[model samples]
Target: MRVMAFDYGTKRIGIAVTDPLQIIATGLDNIHPNNIIEFIKKYLQTELVERFIVGEPKQMDNTPSQSAQHVKGFVNLLKKTFPEMPIEMVDERFTSKMASATIAQSGMNKKNRQNKELVDTISAVILLQSWMDRRLL
Candidate 1:
């Protein structure tokens, strides 16, 4: 079954998709947070997505951050919009940092690294991959 993952932010939401086997997650695109439900509707019509994995931002102390509230609101909207699809949340404390590290290691320039949307997309991909890996274990 295919899976879609989201890294939701106040201004933008990053999208990623997994293959039918649910083994790999690829960065898709960034969408405005307000347009996420519509984006999901459009994407679901084109792809056979079975589930959604959303990142839940947490503090270093493992407590949910303020951003988690927004994510929860987004999740609620998602559930209302797609009642049939399953939704799950994974801790995403360091996914952004990991994404930045990965990009840095790839030899991208400082200017490229500063692209917030690109970093958000990469973080979404990493979050999806982490979910897949956890399921495999």
Candidate 2:
């Protein structure tokens, strides 16, 4: 069973999908926030996803951040759309920072680093990979 992961943002939503065995996650595309629900619904109809893992942003103090509520709403939408699929929240405190650091370390040009959509996709991969690791343990 494959699992889909989302890194929800105000303007864009990043997507990633795990292997059928749930072993690895690959970054997909960043969809417009306004069209995320439709995109997800279409993807679910075409793909064989079994569940969803949404990144839950939290402050350094472990408190829910503003983005967390947005993510929650997105998850709620997914639940309403796909009533049978299970949805889980994974802590995503530093995934963006990690993605940025990784991009910086890779020596990407300034223009690439500044691309929010690209960074968001990478962050989604980070979020999904972290969830996959935790599930293995």
Candidate 3:
């Protein structure tokens, strides 16, 4: 079964999905916070999602970041909506920076690199890939 990942934010939620084999993670899209559930419902109509991996924001000192509270709330909502789907939280430190660097290295235009939605989508991909890598070990 495929897996899904999300980088939760107050305004926008970035989404990524794994292949049916749950191997490669691919950036999908960014949806408004108010539309995330509906977006997922529509996506689920076509894809069989086995689980969800959400990026849990953490500070460098290993404490939960201010945004972590928001993520927790989002996770609660996700659990309520998709009760049967397993949900996992993976620490997301420096993912935004990594995404920016990745975008730069990809030779994306300056405007595209500056797009927060793009960064968020890439961050979700990175988060999912990191979790998948750890599971393989």
Candidate 4:
């Protein structure tokens, strides 16, 4: 079974998907918030997604961040739209920073690395991979 992950934002939602064996996470796409559900539905036509791992943004002290409320609303919609699929939230405190660092170390061109969409996609991958690691432990 494959797992899907999302880094939700007001303007854009980053997506990532794991392999069927659930061992590797790959950045999929960064989509507009308004198109997320439709995009996922289209993706589902060809892929078998077993669960959703959404980033749970939290403050430094572990409180939900201001953006958490929006995420919660989105999760509710997701649950309603795909009732049979399980949804999980993983703390995403430093995934954005980690994604930036990973991109820098990858030798990607500065121009591309500066793109917010790329960072979002990488962040989703980081979130999903972190969850996958914890699940294995």
Candidate 5:
């Protein structure tokens, strides 16, 4: 079973997954927030995901950010929808900026770098990688 991660937002939710060996995280997709359950159900039919890491929005002062309420609601829905699945919330403070910077530094074309979906996917990947790194430390 592999690990999965999500960068949840009101507009779009980003997805990432690790290889079966759990060595690396890769961006998977960006989907509408409302479609997550159905998307997950379809994905699970093809792959075994043992754990999930959801981005926890937080302010600079370490308090939950305004968006945290939405994330909380999503977490509740996720828990109720898949009672047996394991879930974790990891602080996601500046993943978007980091993703944007990484994309810019990668020499990606300006048009592609401007893609919100790509940024979301990379943010999810960053979230998962950080969680995995923390585990190894």
Candidate 6:
């Protein structure tokens, strides 16, 4: 089974999923927040996801960020909707910035570099990758 993750935001949610063996994380989609559950339901018809991960935005001093309340609500909904699946949260402090830097170095054009949706998706991948790495240690 694979693992999935979300970089949640008020506007759009960035999605990422791992291969069945959970070796690599890949950007899956960037969709409206309201569409997340339905998208996951559809995605589940074809994929076996063993666990879900959500990026937990935190402040520089490690307190929950202002958006954390919003993320908590999202998590609660996920729990109510899919109680069977396990959900995990990981620190998401720098994933967006890291994603931006990564895209800058990828030789993509300025137009694509400015795509917030692309950055969000990349951030999800980074978040999932970090989670997998933590499991290794």
Clashes of each: 0, 0, 0, 0, 0, 0
Q: Which residue runs of candidate 3 sit more than 4 Å off their true CA positions?
A: none
Model 6 scores a C-alpha lDDT of 0.97
Q: List the global CA lDDT of all models.
A: 0.92, 0.88, 0.94, 0.96, 0.96, 0.97
Q: What tens digits encode model 2's per-residue C-alpha lDDT throughout 79-110? A: 88789998999998888889999888888899
Q: Over 4 Å off in model 2, which ranges?
A: none
Point out the worst 10-residue segment of candidate 3 by lDDT: 7-16
Candidate 3 lDDT score relative to the true structure: 0.94
- Candidate 5 per-residue C-alpha lDDT over 1-137 given as tens digits, one digit per residue, 9 for 90 to 100: 89999999899999999999999999999999889999999999999999989999999999999999999999999999989999999999999999999999999999999999999999999999999999999
lDDT of the structure predicted as candidate 1: 0.92
lDDT of 1 by residue, 1-137 (tens): 78999999999998999988887899999999878888888887788998999999999899999898999999999889889999999999899999999988989899998899999999999999999999988
Stretches of candidate 4 above 4 Å error?
Answer: none
| Candidate 5: C-alpha RMSD after superposition | 0.6
Q: Determine the backbone clash count of candidate 5.
A: 0
Task: Specify the poorest-scoring 10-residue window by lDDT in model 5.
Answer: 74-83
**Alpha-carbon RMSD to native, per candidate:** 0.9, 1.2, 0.7, 0.7, 0.6, 0.5
Candidate 4 structure quality by residue, lDDT tens digits, 50-108: 99999999999999999999999999999999999999999999999999999999999
Q: Report model 4's TM-score to 2 decimal places.
A: 0.97
Residue 75's lDDT in candidate 6: 97
Off by over 4 Å in 6: none
Model 2 residue 7 CA deviation in Å? 0.6
